[model samples]
Target: MVNKAWRIIPRPLLETVLNNHAQHHRVPQPLILHGPRGVGKTTLILERLLGEWNKGPHLTGYIDFAESIEDHHPQFNKSFPWASWSNCPPPALSSCRSKLEHTLESMVEKGVKLGTISSHQIFTTLNKWHGLNTALRRVIQSNNAASKSAVVGKASPSVLWDRAVFALSARCNAQEIDGVLGLSEKWKGLSIEEASYFREAFLALRLAKEVITVQHGWRANAIAHLNRTGGFSRSLAHSCTDWPCLLLELLSQAAEIDHFQPKLVINNIDVLRNATLNDDSSVSASMYHDSLIWRMIALGANERCLPIILVTSDSYYSYQAYLDFGFTDIFISREMFGWTPQEAKMHMVTDYFSPSEWTVIAEVLGPIPRHLFELYALKQSDYYQKVMGDKGSTFEDIVDAYLAYLQITVVNPAMDNALELLKKFAVDARNGKISKDKLRFGAPWRHPPKTDDPTQCMEWAKLQLMDFVQCLVNTEFGDWEETLHSFFALFILLRLAVVGMIS
Candidate 1:
């Protein structure tokens, strides 16, 4: 049997180092694996952990939102998580938002119904990550006036608060929740008192979300409808403020009910930052709720819930960002997942590259894993053929012969306009060849956003895009036919979108 298509490089030491640190209940610390792009940040740091995290007692869930944008790029909000997760719901936004918040509060109050959001939605599936004593400590602190004042808020007579504590009691021990409040005759309750600090900061962060806004009834008299029949809806409509963040919070605490241990691996913590792009306040408010949920989990992760591993590339690592956003100090520097020059050398050696060739390429590319990988992908004449493949070119010639051949000869853009600076700089920022081509192609981008000759620009764009597709499908460079098929389908889709827009 032969298996060649699917594989990954083994980096067991890095994985072991991360697991050992995160799983340590005695002294857990978050690790940071930050490095420049092309240094194997994605492959080694992210992919390696993803490949082997399941072998342990914990289950991992990843959410990646990077490597989709590049260099000073401006992104449209039409993308998936970017769009749906960040955009506000239509029309009666206020009513929908109120209902959403009320729904969550109700879930916290009366136990979330089994078939509803608490038990059936994403949060339910994620309930295996138990938060033993995390919620209970909050209830304990909320109960004692001295502790409550010292920690978060004044002792307020709120029914929702009591209900929240009762709900917490179901997950944690019904009796132990009471016992933690009292210390044994021999031992002092110093640890419990100190631990209230964790609960306080988390609760303080969440206090805004729990604001009690009581609306007056429309009854003429007290007896109009004395008894309130039932409670809020269990499952909520998709229309709500901070829906994604709330969903994340609910998922994070889902396992808290029964004290099940599950690891949640949310990738690309950086992408959430984009929510602020549209309306900073709304996004910030939602993130506060998310932070509160993580804060609770983080405060008690060592002695309680399973490790919630958050992944991101070095470009947007959340280590400093977490602190900058006023999050509780829960993460420790887990590990720096980057290859050394020796490791890069080993990668080249493993790929069957000769020392003499790799040495020269390595010196030129400067030990970047991605750069090395791209160079190794093409065989002999791969280096020079790309450099001066078809010209009176010298090694000293300053030109991207590799990209030029790969573009025109291998993977060309529109036939004639391939060299046109406008289309070249369309998707990317003005850099290197793009800047030079601008002088040659004559800054067409300088035209108004709605150009005077829209049809010409449109035609040129269509031709360039199709030419790009042709190169992609060309087997000479790589077998990208299936990918090209998908691209063509997307082209048809874009056409339909354009038609719809016109209509």
Candidate 2:
């Protein structure tokens, strides 16, 4: 038999949403993909990445805030596949650093009315700076006119910037520098401020060029640091926000470069939540609040005509809230596909265990997942045979074994509380006389009513009592209290009926 364990179920609704994202490049608003654990939210996002959205100018990022990246020792073999920060090449890191430095330098030099700068512009400026730095280093190294010492110390900023362009040309054997520099190249001979502004613009262009090729698709880069004393400050959250903003800027810059608005697909946000929320308890409250920040980013991206797709597992927001956030579409779980209780039972029984074992297994496990059902099923047989083998396979023997397990493992510690509650419920039922209304409404009863024959009420009450007792075999005191209250009410009605018949 094929191991059906690995079978992939197609979630059509998720696929439809992803398809819309890919084709329309529109952001899905308030798409709450909620389900019980093990229902494959993460799996769906991965599939979307590899399948339809593979070719789009989309940058996907995953952040599991629940995992602590800071704890990973620096000396740990950096080449390990799952080594959080080690997967990227040195060139990529160097490129990122250069871009960030250049962008900051450009921003500072242009003094481009800081508030007027779009987040994308800031990101582009940074990336371009890095590319400029790389090109400058290469060009200076290759030029006979510029000695290493002079290049490092006395080289003009414009010259340093040009070297980057030359280096880029030599590496790619293409005039990419011109395309990136755009109108900035025309202001090379202007005033110092003008020159600086143009250079900043040039740096931004170079950064945008590199980002399209160098960055991995759909990978969330989260920076997590723990204070030596073990708490997170507001500074940490701000630092985390910086990278995502840069990324969003990159997407915006891509649209500028291509002159066609680019679409962004934001998925696997839970991964980020898990990463940021992992281990460090101080930032947990902020984790929930971060969704609002993300919503703002989404709206900002949308306003710039960049299509944004945000996929999340949270279902707390109303449709109107999502609409207000500028989400054009919504995909929810109930509106999608999910397993019903009966379907879950059937799937577990047929797919998990043999038919011969299912009945006994279901009796112990009820209708849940296969793993849970199997756990209880295995316990029932092994426990009964080991503890009561000589007694044989009788109903009483099974009940006795179950009760013994309950006493030893489940209710033993809470038995006193359970008995007290049960007694209290019994007294309450005795106090209530047997009127049909009292029988129907009385405390915590589960017995079915006897419409015609009042005498049958006693049998119904006894059966309910037995069920209640069975439920208590391995249950908590609180559960026992509730069950007893119901049975007690029924018993009182039975007593009242008995008195009425005699009168």
Candidate 3:
């Protein structure tokens, strides 16, 4: 059986550069690997690069934000990988976001645990930040009415102290208590502003302590405690800074313990932008900036000298993000390129494709690894069987069939009348109904056609095709204006290939 997806041809030169930047001696600047869709950026990092790096003592973490933001574009056929992978009716953005956040926290915690050499150090840090002593001192230092008379340097432990002690001691008892009653009471004494600040900081510390010490059901217990006490709030959702701070702190400590700066690979980070669009839920754009997740990670990488690689297929979205986050200067970008024809043939599976077959494949698909894979997959599909239907399974036959499949499944679903309009335009040019200048220059796509019957309008077809290319096609194709003619030429070639005119 032919594999639908194949391993990316290793780029020794690119890998060397990546390895140089990913050195453990010092933290490298954040790397943004930008490229067109399906150029093997994800596969390169996840499979080849990470696999090589994992052989060493270094630790690495990865997360894909795209997993949360599904493509809702309608796909008529599931024969091709791209169409099959795109979700029709995507899952709710809110649910997806919640899941992503949880996954991020979980990844952070797991990384911390894996790298932690001393739980005792973690316990001591937790005590210093949010233990009973810290809580009592916080109350004494408060400017609230309840603590007006309390001296910061020398203060007696109030009833709050005794209750907190009991809560701590109860951990050893048959029935364990959270030891937060006194802390929660004192937490309410401060002003609303102070309370919100105090709660996030305190809870973040508490969660870290629980994660390091308890190890199991810590997240559930923490959430249950918050819910039971009505402590969960909207501020904690997006605007929360404490958790992000804690995550960085924990990562730093883990790096210190492991004696090597761990690498962080975050893929499809532009999904932060995607999540905001068309979302009816409470998820907002401000969350990306206000929450310390992205910006904070960048800051942490620079400060701690941790190697952080942020991958995005969408350069425009990332550029906007870089500006909004005020870290345009921090990221060092590397543009991932597709294979060259000479290079592609060197790595091509000669056993599957003879020399002649590969020449035709290369000529049609250019040097794109993804297109080649999709074509290979299409040949083995039921769609291929339907297209071939007792015809010889030649390379040209499969290429023609793939083009037809793309038109019927991907293109037609998006723009129903595009192909028919092209056919009519071709006929119009042949019969002298269309002028020589019009045929040479092609249809003007200045404005969308204003007509009830869009299928009959060539301008509408051109505009619709441009729109589809902009959204569904790879961003590396340059401007839609420039690619418009090349795109139409593909359809024209498809028509010729189907009728055996191309040969």
Candidate 4:
């Protein structure tokens, strides 16, 4: 396994996707991968796709319109190796029409000699014909002449082919098709049949524009044209099934024909509630619903043969929603990323300070993780310099400042209740031979009661007992004897709750 803590891992998931893709002999129509921003969801997807494409003939395209003028225009292209494998362009309007003409002429010449004329034969024959620009034009002219008289001319392969290709190229524009087909001078090896498939697939790309337009109306004209011409029918539709019902239907056609799958991943779902709504309050009301659609599309795509993964933060928003939807297998952060305390400390120190400063910081902050200890140390250091003018203070001075700071700044009136409870426990325990019942006061008790409770009595009293015993053991009278005498005096006054003595 890869170092998941340091980076998002991809190999295991990629193998699963490739196996599924090969078994089905078609790419999944939808897949979703989601997670927190820094957790590397996008990195995982790109690496996995690149790995699979490296092993076989596959095309992978990526579009990150997160910062684009258009909200959802994907950047699509073939992956390497296959990217170098072949080059082909779908029939352009001018080129396809010309090819139909030439093919029809050849078929006519062949028919004249063969003498087997049938309407179905003509349609099927023309459909099967593969030709260049000249052949296409000949086919179109013949079909037009043949259909001049009928109420609605019987749809011929020549007519259907011409119309389909023309409509597709016109809507997509030359620049778009050039990008899609990756046209180059060295691209001449692609067969006419392969070119036709490209044309059909390009049409699917055009249809997918509907999804973009629904969210952003600025692209409406382009979207409408693609939809009318049936151009958006491929991966775009497959990836966008979680969109609106109408858009889903339009994109579904592409999936049906090509078996293209789409995947969705939703991460940081906890932030969904913080998502901004417009003046109309529309986005707010629909945010959860929209999130649901996102997951639904992912689930639907997975079931329809697409691999979908959803990554989420350790937040109730995502956890509760996935649980409610019964998508329990969806991976959580614990599986995606893990860090030991030491590793976490290392990251924090490296991120916030230089290597030379680590030793000094460790001294001040102790062995605790940087999150808890760094701020505490910095604040204490700052206060020491400001109040006592002692930048190079001794440990005793630092401890006294820390206690004072805690009393003055950290413990507010809001903490009065908790302090009172602690004080009550302290006072009760100080009274003669504090019982176990009194010691247990204010402590939380859970089921299967603890047998050996460590916090059963006062810590100060235990320490004083240890000191007295040490005095006895060593037979030392100087400071140890004085300490024992002071402790005994304090113990008697505490039992009596004498105001000036124990307080």
Candidate 5:
């Protein structure tokens, strides 16, 4: 896919999220970015992640839960498919590192910036294991020349080699057991039999990426040691120890913004809510029971008091999980909404979008930024492009093209029902039953069961109908009296017209 410039039209919701935690300079808990699906929640955070990668001194551990990666996130090319979700749960070292590798790649782009180290991981004994990413030679050759120019005076491969060993010597914080909390046995898994030259080898791989990303033809002999065993993961799982420490110093030493700097950003966290652990019959439910996200909250996220943001689509926000985990205090909920009239008008003034088309879109699709983006993408597409350039430029003309794009672009089973409803509305609008004052989206169901005397089943059905109507009236159209009166009048008019036609 071709790259598009990320033009994030700022809204009140966007400003609130960007500043909410940063103001305190300490994230007492994760900032929960909550919103309806496809409302540009992912796009908003990703803007801050990649577009502003170096602007903020944050070390993000982004985990996308969708089993497979989509084009929604910024593309780093073919070297990144492995960085997508692997079968491991978030708590698993491999799972977390997949996300951290994203962070690693971003760091490579900006050139690794490290602050003074106050904390380090130490292991009494280190062992040898075979795990390194192969195919570095080809990857390095493919990166652009400008990328090479960016790392003019950055660390040499040899110095990075030493830093890798230092990271390993600090034990990279694998759960070690001092035997006090009964973690002694658990700690041994990380300490015993580590790859002998794993640190050197892994740094060689990273240095290779840096060279490819920023130094061009600067080759390293260490690249030969890179292989595709468990090598990539084994080295990566060790860095989780360094990330929080590395982040702490970076955040601490940074120039204060809102008098504090944020250290982390967690994206697409539905994996923490969904993935299964081991051979458990229940998948998401089980993962939800002992969440790594919750564990992180209880540990450094809360204790260190660093500003952090956790973003997820409302489709997977799961309020039940929130209640189950008692996460009331772990996150400050920020619910995103559609653009206001002024914001929508403001966005239209930009160079990329035309005011005439957007004014109609806001009226039709209700100022949803995501829908606007989708419509923009549709118009830019080759199939729709010809019509845009060659056809009439009227509002109706644009609406017609939008309808055609909608029909084919997002084809789904649910749209059949929606389209049928739309047909009924079109008939009503044509008959003058719908006006600006009473814009009914879908007509009420016409048929009712014939009954002289009410049976128990009929009574039950009546109660169900009232409940459903109440929900619709309350949520869909807010004016209770006017909404019901208008609907009742429209129904009576329809019934009278039907009898007159029969006569």
Candidate 6:
């Protein structure tokens, strides 16, 4: 794992755009960072922007949906291995979707408490407001006495949710009372609005606590199904949606009292679009669920005056959420298609490589930052340098070595079915079904026409090559015309035509 920092080529211009909106007194429209995959959307948001924002009076919450999905199933990297190579059903797809809203709530809670107070303090205050925790006072005091050093640790939102839920449930059970609702009589001095806010926020946190607690159960069920049946099950139940409004409203009110700007950065929202593709329902219906989420968040952003920044590598823009969610009217879009050739050359000139060496490497890898950064690691390896020794110019050998590496790491990992598709397309090219002009132009793979059939759509949604086609589509030849000029593509295509590849 290369440090992503080495791969980052700073874009001060984009940072200024982000800062302009972030620093605004009034809530600016939601900011969207859009690009194809591997063009550094997450790195820029996490490393460059949020780091600086967190150090200021601004409170920030960041979540990468893709990372969360992958976290639940370690067997699948970002490559989404099951969809590419296995017959087993994708694990934790439902779990990830079920937890989405609550996960956002957790992030909101994180922002609200950022740098201002500890989670213990907030929970204590919240308990006082709800007036249901007289039984826990001794327990809290004893715990505090038992672990003076440990008190500073484990104050994350999920932990806070878990503790709050436990205290409330135990108190309610012992008294044979309803949950938060039964505590209405305790709202002695509070105004009606204040009482309502406390009640709703507590209920929302309780529901979020349940969703977080059940995640492990979902994973266990997924693994059990995979072991016994050799297939995946998406039978996990979903959480209710009303909790997000309560969560957001509470966060907004807290920010007003604290007098700090709050920003939320959500990365890889396209995972929602991808997860929904596995749904058994119609595509439109699947999209409708995600659409509702957009409307909720968009409206919340306005009402709460909470600035939100969205980062996605979804090239199709999740079927244009801008138009469908009316985001065009309320969002500012920033596109990162990697750097220009001249910009790459300038950025590549550093301590790692000389002028000529870096120039050749940049030209070979194009403007793609990931590949260029990879070369830094390759150059540092003694074994790699030994392999390339005195064969040719360092440039030529390095380029050849990098291409060979890609063949093994990228092209070779494609599922047998995906390789067959590529070979069949190649044969069609040889037989004139695919014209030379079309091949030269790098035309999109013509998938089967979408019908009303769910089975057909499911078949179409399985990406046979995992990240292989995605890498090309997103990073190198965003337009196929560039494919002909990309030596990398030509090299991979030539290698895949061999019968040994499919076998």
Return the top candidate by TM-score: 3
The Cα RMSD of model 4 versus the native structure comes to 22.0
The regions of model 1 sitting more than 4 angstroms off are 1-7, 21-32, 45-47, 55-57, 67-260, 276-281, 284-305, 314-319, 322-330, 335-337, 380-503
Sort by lDDT, top down from the best:
3, 6, 5, 2, 1, 4
lDDT of 2 by residue, 428-480 (tens): 44555334453454434452442434345545545554565555454632243
TM-score of 5: 0.48
All predictions: root-mean-square deviation over Cα?
17.1, 17.7, 12.8, 22.0, 18.3, 13.2
Model 3 clash pairs are 27-305
Indicate the residue-level lDDT of 323 in model 5.
65
Candidate-wise lDDT, in order: 0.38, 0.40, 0.51, 0.34, 0.42, 0.50
Q: Would you estimate the TM-scores of all the predictions?
A: 0.40, 0.38, 0.58, 0.36, 0.48, 0.55
Model 4, 1-503: lDDT tens digits are: 01112323333554465345433322334333332223333455455554553233222223221211121212333211100000112112222212322332332222222222222333232233222233333333433554323313555544555443444455456655445455443248656665444544444333223223233333335434544564542333322222233222222222322233322233322223233322321223123334444444443555342222333332332345446544764432123322333554566444544454445444443332212232335434555456546556544454455445434532332133223333344554454444665334231331112222335433433443344445544653224344344333223322221211111
Error of 2 at 332 (Å): 7.9
Q: Is candidate 1 or candidate 6 better by lDDT?
A: 6
Question: How does candidate 4 score on lDDT?
Answer: 0.34
lDDT of 5: 0.42
User: Who is ahead in TM-score, 1 or 4?
Assistant: 1
Stretches of candidate 3 off by over 4 Å are 1-8, 25-28, 68-238, 257-260, 276-286, 289-294, 380-393, 413-503
Q: Whose lDDT is higher: candidate 2's or candidate 5's?
A: 5
lDDT of 6 by residue, 1-503 (tens): 12234545578998888888776523635677876444566667767888777655566767555554543333364442212112123223454444555555655545432323233434543443232332233233333454334434546444544454454444434232223244445557567675444443444355434443443333454444443554423232122222343344445545543356666677655554455333322222134345435544555565544667777655445236667666465567788767777787777665556787766765566666656666777777775658657566455686788778766755455444454554454455545675555444332543332243544433433432433455555654444454334232233333332111221
For residue 232, what is the lDDT in candidate 2? 46
**Residue range 1-503, candidate 1, lDDT tens digits:** 11123235566776676666444322333344543333454565456665555443333444443323332112444322111111222222233234334434433322222211222233222223322223433554554534444434333333334434433334444244234323233135446654343233223223323221110111112212221222221111111133333433553344342332234444443444443223211223233334433443443453343354555443324345456545635455444433556876776654546666556555544454544454444443345556557578644332244345434532232223232433433433323433433333323533212333545655655654555444543654235455444332223322212111111
Local lDDT at 342 for model 1: 81
